[model samples]
Target chain A: MDHKEFIRGGTALSEDEIKSGKIFVEEDALDCRYAWDTGVAIGRYLAELKKGKIIAKKTNCCDRIMIPPRMFCELCYRPSGAWTYVQDTGVVNTFSISNIYYDASRVPSGEPNPMPAVIEIDGASKGMGIMHLLGEVKPEDVKIGMKVKAVWKPESERTGSITDIEYFKPY
Target chain B: MRKVAVVGAGMTKFARRALETPKELSYQASKAALDSAGMKLKDIDCVAHGSAPDAFDGIHQKGEYLADGCGGWNKPTMRVFVGGATGVHAIAHGWYHVASGLADTCLVVCEEKMSSAMPHAQAFFLTIFDAITERALGLNLIWIFALEMKRYMERYGYTKEDMALSAMKNKNQGLKHPASQFYGGNELTVEDILNSEVMASPVSRLDVSPVSDGAAAIVLASERTARRLTDKPVWIEGVGWCLDTAYWATRDLYYPRYTEIAARKAYKMAGIREPHKEINIAEPYDPFGYKQLHHMEGLLLSPKGKTVELLRDGHFDMDGNLPMCPSGGLLGVGNPIAAAGTLKLCELFWQLRGEAGERQVPGNPRLGVAQAWGDLMQVSSVVVMGINNA
Candidate 1:
């Protein structure tokens, strides 16, 4: 009388079973590419990075300053105000020293551990931040409210992208 | 609004990698649900479909590609997407279709094919981040989840073991579910979950739901049509959905305010003021072990920062005060994204009708709530169902 018994369907395929050549399987990769527009806010923000400066938008609503800058304020449904430069220093809102990579594979023991954090930038609206890597400090030393500064690539090597600032380090 | 009730539900076995194509998975689950309702495709008035990102399935215009498989052919076929919340939102859309005089019957279907995303589903998620700011930061999906989990534990002083018990609970619950990925022969303890490989300090490998390929389907009809189809119809008392800002960083990671707002909307419509007592059973989205606790608090079923204590007291057990995830949830049932949410609705349908058999809870439960959260940790969809229309 169990509903589970009457319930049915779905063919589970183990790796070995899939490779056993019993089922006719056709494999194809999703070959696709995209050119994502940086938009007026992000495009200008990225360009400012080459000059070794961080820029943010001061929205008309509540005078909220935002990074990863948007041309409009999401909450108030209005156009953002003037763009303003922000300090590169920030506080780590939250962070994690992860041993897993994007591919779901464990990091090799010898590889450097990745410490990713949401750094609440100074001069931006409260709790408004962008995610980035942490460096120049031991994983155990990273604190929630830790003050950090951007470690930028040499000016000549700047690429007008987020990578222009290599990582954030404890101030 | 008019009344709409769920007449039947169906699901495919949640598997790590289903050999069936996306269409085949949809067809199988759709067939089972239609058969359960004792109705044919012609009896359906319209179809509402849902699925996660096209990147996960490796197919563009997935809604169109999946239409025929879901019996949406030649009808007012439509797809509703809200990332992971697609499943529950599909039901909401179906309710709209039937409740607004558009149709007398509606079949809602949800599917996910994570196995087809070549390099890894996690890798595909990297592109989901802000291309200008986050994509270049070398982030995987684990970073954000771990960050949120860390913030939650830090705020509430919850330990790894505290969250691991949830994983253990759902794993145990899954044994009763026939379609569960961890259904039988695989029972785990709290220690096993704690000792497993840590993905990010607080989030262990076991805490994460398995990447699955499967589908789920449910049939909804207007009041008159539902009564004619089945004597024991589970009335869709209320449906609600909310989407918060995409700026997840600025949002509170310790609590999901979006889910609470969505739950409030549903509670108001269902005429239930006290959710912690009125609702008999609940299935909140649980892609991570901590999320079940997070969403429980979000649903107002348990007090904030205290769900862990209640969880430790066995309040969420199958026979406890409120049985949560009696269908094993995503942790044990296997998460195929969209299908997982729809399966939760199916759980409510079966449980409310007392047709769960051995998997049924001890109480003669009459009212239940199912919810799903998704899309940059910003959206939540909620549905309230009961034996009789409120």
Candidate 2:
């Protein structure tokens, strides 16, 4: 008959206990399944990545190729068409320093925090970027505009997921 | 020309947590408003309910789920959302119903149930980021605000002390408001805010609004019904609402241009050239301490970037030249998303009728404006009202 009992995670106590100030209940369940439809363009892009290839949609309006092809250009909101290839190298545009674990509920609860970076993927035009975890560098040593390279997972281990690349480290 | 007036209003007993379901809360509030308006659920031609997000309640299709609770059963009912602005937006929509002759009386309700979500409310806010982009950046919702606060401070040459002054003034007013979350608190000092736990750099825990569970509702009726309902029906003199583009990164962060545009539209309709001199009271949305100053700047009641100075000079206090947020605002009144905005409308109603005992602003105050801002700094909704002619 308590609200906390219906909640997904953590210990449940009686309302009387909480009201009496004898206990404070906190739930910690992080089980979240976000069902999202990636649509036609993105679905194809993900399939290509699974085949060990990268695809960028070409836009006639901007005369440029965009990664994770969108239905419309983010800048001009025009239609984009056809997949193109770009080398796996790009420069960092702007980045932030993060010293936190990616997700506690998704991973082992007590593991150490992961170093993360929003890297500008290589082979793309300037300012095009991807957010990938950063490894091999000390948290205190990470700086904005730092050069880094992606270290992909083994061919046997690659899944089309974002975790396909183990992390980005110093080039 | 058809004119619409607010016939009735109701709200839940605000609290940090409400044991009842949002439907139950909505039923409670809506029933009161309908009863006060001397109308039945069937009398409502249209119903508009505002809830900020499905994420807050952890229920998808929130509008559909909340529909029946708002008396939407088998009639024309729709949900309006603009983050924190949804509450006022609901009223604006209701005004259209009566003013356009589409409906004789409209039921408008705003509800938020922050307690229904798992973990803390802050945890739910983590999803506001692009999972692949900003999530890995170790960014909390506080980070965005802290960044904005830092930028606002740097650009406006506002010290943390000036921001603390707002906390003091609002909290003092909160003491009188029964529903205020921060009521009866000792005066906060500049050192208090700086020393508070830093959720993100420059944004202390004290700077944020509390997650609240509540609901508020109002009934808007045509001019004929307004005379029958009550002697003091508040008239909707002007309304303006607008949304900005979603590309927040490209836009300037210091000033809220959308609010200015929305205010201009509302003021033009209300036929006011000098807002400070003409408009007697205001309730500019203040989810955070510095946001009051930021929105005041956007409202143009104060000169560009000069609100902190006005606030410092006691210009916006309860008895100042232009009284603001006599209801204690989202900061003190507890931010229940959509309900917070409707609470402002309720405050305006109470203030204009001289019914706001203890919290009432001085003078024969007549016209007042309530504005709500939300949606990643993109949306603004304004409603200007006046006391019904005696």
Candidate 3:
């Protein structure tokens, strides 16, 4: 409610009478930095990804293999039971080919237009999937239930992270 | 009226961003609460969901969106909103559902994802101002809180070090909390806080709680269901709330009149006269350092203008007579808005049940109080809790 904090500041940049022979514009880079925790389920999943394998948690009660694993199973209010490996190969549940970046900048024709997709991995419960980028395929070619496999970095380059899997492409 | 008691509590590790979707966060916290109560979604007769400022999550009608995650699928569900007070208010909302014989059990869930807001969550706070008179002012929470801190300091002659102590105490207490999602392990000193970069005069960067994305939930049940659920139940002894005028400019910045009124109503329902002597612990919403002292006075836990003296004497520490923010409160645990507010009540539940683990205070503390303030410094929500009082 106090207007004094806003009004008592330096001169506005657009003033015709420039102060100190400079037009100093205020820079309010309001973007904030965030470090998100993956928790135990995703934490272990990422570790498995570093080893060139996909992992999921087996729910104790519902007996479903959950993707992007977590500590507790939402279905039955029970802690997840087992860490089971899943096939790198998956079937595309859905997809979208984006020709622009998040900020609406055009994706240059020289570079690959990112094809983001929901890929339902084999061995996971039906329709249990992850959203990832699809590569090595054309926009018109990618269709529902199209089989795809993860493209991984060399073992030496693996850093125990999600990016270990470069992208998914039709095998 | 049927008696209601909290039988279980749970929370996710707070962080700058949860990385998981808001629904997933709600699911985790809700699952934990239900698991702690040895129950399932089917056992919950209703749900009370709370979130503050849709701008934080960037989703409208988030309550309905989160209903299934909160175990409210096809069940009676209510969404509560009142800015920062949504946490305590939602719990009270659930309490009434059980207290009014409308439900045998209610699951209260609160979540916030401030990191989803672009630029910064503070940007959304700017929109909460009075449009015609205040929107063009470009003010943020820090600016307003700084003004209030200045008023309190000038009135009581309190120094920065005096305010800094609250931050110091809470941060140290946070080390024991695994869910203290924002802060890394650091035992802070008052001098470290006072010397930190000043956001506004008397309000340093360390004075404020970090923006966080997380969720918390608690399970409430009627006396019959409560007895069958757990050996120990924390009774909801009292619940009260009040909203003052949004014309914060006209109100005195030195005190929160609404919180006092809210506390009085809660105290009367709980049948308490001497809150300072009766209540063993308190969590009074410390999103800022001085606010701990400011709200301590407002909650009537500390004499007006003398909170600094008690703070200086280590009266609000873990081993002190009355441990405030023993769950590290919001300043240390990270404030995910509604989730953090609900976490305060969850802290009281855990403490009263002797289940606080590393953060447990001595003396087998029984009675406790939690208060949340929000919305242009106008709204206050208060809840009094106890054990063996049912």
Candidate 4:
């Protein structure tokens, strides 16, 4: 049996077809809002970040210190033992130098390429990291295992969010 | 457990922009699948629908909206989701419906109208990130793949040229696929890919699959129902799906442990210890050029850091030792997320039954595997299928 005979062509709508209302189109925006609870662990972690400090949740079951602190241990499934302050310094786990914007449009010429990295925080277990932007260095200079420090906003400008640390830079 | 087989499969031509609404696309594929099975909507006992986020379609509760089109007016219906894994997972759900003795016949449908999210389909992709932590950093979906591609290349010592082979081969194969969105039937060289404009570093425009609007469907039935319906039934030998933690940052990006676990589960159920020797053809998801290699490693089809070598040696070519992506895959066929993954299963169904016309691999291919990876590099869904020679 010819599979081609079973497959059907999709209806392609041209701009004129839509404009002439030959093809009906609905116009609306998704205006959904979400106010997610930060929960105990992340809430406290955010509070510490607002004070210009990086904190992690420590688990007694194992010596693992989890960044972006969680209330429960993922491996042991037990409540985290305590909150430990980790250094703002970290090593880049992996990085990307993107010339495209979020919507996939090309970034304008002469603008700095956005460099994002998964930086494994110092004093945390191996590979315990968070996603953030990189700054204060050329895109070419960013390397895996490159030591970096958080570039925090001014104390007055700090918000209780991950943006509290503006970005990470070469320490 | 009872046996389940795929009696029929269908897919619409993938396009960048489709005039049909999400429901219409679902109806087209579902009706074609039913027609291929020589069955009617009234004959189906249940409907299993799979789609990605409702944000892309701009319709909330998209499953409920797509129900009637998929022949779920009064039948037992369910929607399965696991990011991009939803398509294969939906088929797994249909298999369960038949194998569990709850239903004798089931219809599995997957649809994605990425063009509906105007300006760009990627805008909806941004919401998949962590709300409190990752989103504020101004990260986009491409960044994660770029980072992983960089890591995979660095760890394996593979080059962009090595990855481009997949892009070139898949696109060349797409020439034969009628449902492919980018099927210009043109040949592309590695230089063509290397010279393509860079979207993310190490990931050029050619490295990624195009966002597409499409739908695909398959009809599944129990042993008795399948025997009655068709002489050439493709059996669903095994199914597996696994997900890693949402804390994607902490894990190593070079290899997909979740895909390994999922493949292992499926292989165990299929009673196959060695996938490389046992599985004849493989359709590992290839949204990006390197991802085919990444998932091949995860599927244990190739050893760690060995896929590129095999690829360069023509091991994974359509006529090579182990043919990969004989249906052109997402890179050539177009990627409508959930729908694209389901399309892989359709290819396997066609290939196992020797029904795949121009894209059919040489040799009487008896067994094949289709796998999908999604959700921030977390989930993996796999299905092993074979012809019912008995």
Task: Give stretches of model 1 more than 4 Å off.
Answer: none
**Higher DockQ: candidate 2 or 3?**
2
lDDT string for model 4 (B113-144, tens) is: 89878889886778889888888876777888
Q: Against the true structure, what is each candidate's TM-score?
A: 0.97, 0.77, 0.69, 0.98
- C-alpha-based local distance difference test score of model 1: 0.89
Candidate 2 per-residue lDDT, tens place, B18-96, comes to: 6667887788778877866778887788998999878777678899999988899898998988888898898998888
TM-score of chain A of 3: 0.80
TM-score of chain B of each: 0.98, 0.95, 0.98, 0.98
Fnat of every candidate, listed in order: 0.70, 0.01, 0.00, 0.75
Which candidate gets the maximum DockQ versus the true structure? Answer: 4
List, residue by residue over A1-171, the lDDT tens digit for candidate 2. Answer: 111111111122345766797755455444677766657776676566666566677787887666656677766788886677665444433332322222212224355345443455555545456545667776566555578766666777766655656677776
lDDT of 1 by residue, A36-118 (tens): 88789889998999999999999888778988788888878899999899999999988999998877778999998889888
Number of the candidate with higher TM-score, 2 or 3: 2
lDDT, candidates in the order shown = 0.89, 0.72, 0.80, 0.89
Compute the lDDT for candidate 3. Answer: 0.80
Model with the higher DockQ, candidate 2 or 4 = 4
**Which window of ten consecutive residues has the lowest lDDT sum in model 4 chain A?**
A5-14
lDDT of 2 at B378: 77
lDDT of 1 by residue, B1-390 (tens): 689989988889989888888899999898888888989999999999999998887778999999999999999999988888898999999999999989999999999989888767888888777777778777877789999998899889999999999878887888878898776766888999998988876788999888898999999999999889988898988889999878788776889999999999999999999999999999999999999999999999999999999998989998899999998899888899899999999999889888897689876898999999988888999999999633
Error of 4 at B147 (Å): 1.0
